[model samples]
Target: MTGGISRVSYSGMLLLGPGTLPLLALLALPLSWVQVGKLNGDVVVQCDTLEPHISWTLNGEQEPMAELVAEGQNLTILGLDLPATGNYSCWAGPVLLDTTYVVVSSTYEEEMDVTCQAESYHGSFHCSWPGPPSAVFRARLTHSDGSVGLWVPVAGGHGQFSVSLADPSFCPFGEELRPLRLHLEGLSDTSYLSLSRHFFLRDIVRPDPPQELTLRWQGEQLHLAWAPPASWQLPKSYFALLYHLQYELPNGTQVERFVEGVEETQVQVGAQRVRISCRDPYTPPAWSPWSPWQDLNAPQ
Candidate 1:
C-alpha cells in the first residue's frame, strides 16, 4: 500500500439495519443522474456497493447532502430542497464507484390574478396580485407603438402587495387619450403569470375636481367663474387652460361648452346646474375631474 488507491471489490446483495430505507442501487452505468421533486420529496439512489458502509458528498465537498451514518447499497435523499439541487456522488471504502446528479426541480401553479389601475396618466400606475411570499415579481409598461419600460419587481407577498410607478413623462399630456398598457410578470418555482392590464388613461382621469365655481346674477345675465385646479408640479405655462363647462337647462337639454383662456374668470350664463373641469389645450383630451355641480345664481 505505497501511494496507491485500492479498489473495493463489488459483489452481490448486502443487508442493512432493519429501519434503513429500502433503495435499489443499480451499478450498470458508469455515471447516473437523478432528478428530485420538491415539497418534502424523498428519492432513493442505487450505489455500487455490497458492503455495510457507504459515504455521500455533494459536488465532491466534505459536506454531504446525505448523512454518513447510514451505509450499504441504497442512498435516500430527503426533501430535495433548492439547496439540494446538485451533483450527488458516493464512494464505497474510498473507491469512486457511481455518481448520481440530483437536479432539484419543482412544479408551479399558474393561477395568480392581477388587479391593476392607472392612478395618474402622466404620473404613474399600480398593480397587485396574491402570490407565494417567496415568489419573485416584475412589472413594466408596453406601449402599442412597441416601446417598453424596464421590468420592475413587485415586492412583498402572501396574498397582497402594491407597486406604484410615478413617472408621468412616459407619455406626454393628452397622450392619456391613447393610454398605456401595464404588464405584470411573476416568477417562482411554484407559480406563473403571463397576463397584463390595459385601459383608457382618460377613463381613469381622477384629478382633484376643479373648485371655486361661482355664479352671480349680474343684471339679467348670470356670471360664472372658477380658478384652475392645483397641480403636483409647477403650473405648466405652455397652454392657456381650457375648461369644459356643462350645464343642464330647465327644459332638460344639456349643453357642453369649451371655454378657452379662463383668464377672464367670468362668463355670462343662464342654467340650472353647472359643472366645470379643466385641461390644457396643448394637452387636449386629458382633462381634470369635473368640479362639483354649482346651482344657478338667484333669479334663475
Candidate 2:
C-alpha cells in the first residue's frame, strides 16, 4: 500500500482498502434522539423510559415543569392560561410527538335566574328554574334558627324544575318568608350554585265576610243585609255570596230561600210574620249550626 490507498492481492485481482474504517463505522451507528413537536392541554406518549428529559415550548418560551413518562403517566396541562392563539410543541424519542393549536379562552360563565311562588298552602314556597336535562340539581334551605334543612325537590327536568321546602318546618320566617332560596349543582362536585336574588311567595288571603246584618221593614217585602267579617284577607276573586237563608213563621213553619251575590242586611217578607237565620250553601242545614234567628217585630 502506498499513500492513503492500500491494495490487497485477492485471487488474481487487486483490492483497495479505505483509509478510515473506524470513522466510517462510527458514522453508520444510530444515536438516540427525539424529534421536536408541540402540544396543548393534555397528551400521553408511550416510550421506552419515563426518565427522559421532556421539554416543551409555548410559542417560543420553554415550559416551566414539563414531564416525560415511560410507563405512560397521564400528562395534565390544564389551566395553563394559554394565549388566545399560539403554537404548542412537545418532543418524544427524538421525534416530534405532539403539535397542537393553542386556543386561549375568555372563560365560560353562566348566569341563572330563579323565581319562586307559594302554592295554595301557607309556609310553602315553590321554585322554578331553567337548566339542562340529565343534569343533577339540589336544593337546600336555611332556617331562621341558623340550622339547615335537608334538600327538597320540586320537579326535575332538563329545562326547568320546581323545588320547595320539605315541610313548613323548614320555613324559618313562617308565612313571612315570601320567596325562598334555590341552589343549583355546579360543574365541580364540591361547588354550589345559588340564585342571585330571592323571590316572594304569593300571599293569598281570604276576603272579608259581610258586616252589620240587618232586617228591614217593607209591607210584604222583607229585606236582609249584612257586611262580611272584617278579618278576611283573601281577595274578592274568591269571594262569592255563598249562603242560604231560611225563614220560620210563628206557626212553627219554615221556608228556604236562595240568594245570589246578596249581602243585603234585609230580605223581603213574602207574607208570613216570621224569624230568619242564614246558612252557608256548601254546608247543608245538618252540618251548619244556624245563625240566631231575628224576629221582624222583636224589640231591640
Candidate achieving the largest TM-score: 1
lDDT of 2 by residue, 41-149 (tens): 3333232335455545544456534342323322334333323123344556456544432222212115455655432324555666665443335566664333566
Index of the highest-lDDT prediction: 1
Residue 183, candidate 2: Cα error in Å is: 2.4
lDDT of each: 0.54, 0.40
Give the range of the ten consecutive residues with the poorest summed lDDT in model 2.
7-16
Q: Lowest-scoring 10 consecutive residues by lDDT in candidate 1?
A: 1-10
Clashes of 2: 48
Alpha-carbon TM-score of each model against the true structure: 0.42, 0.32
lDDT per residue as tens, model 1, 48-70 = 66656777776667576553333
Query: Model 1 TM-score?
Result: 0.42
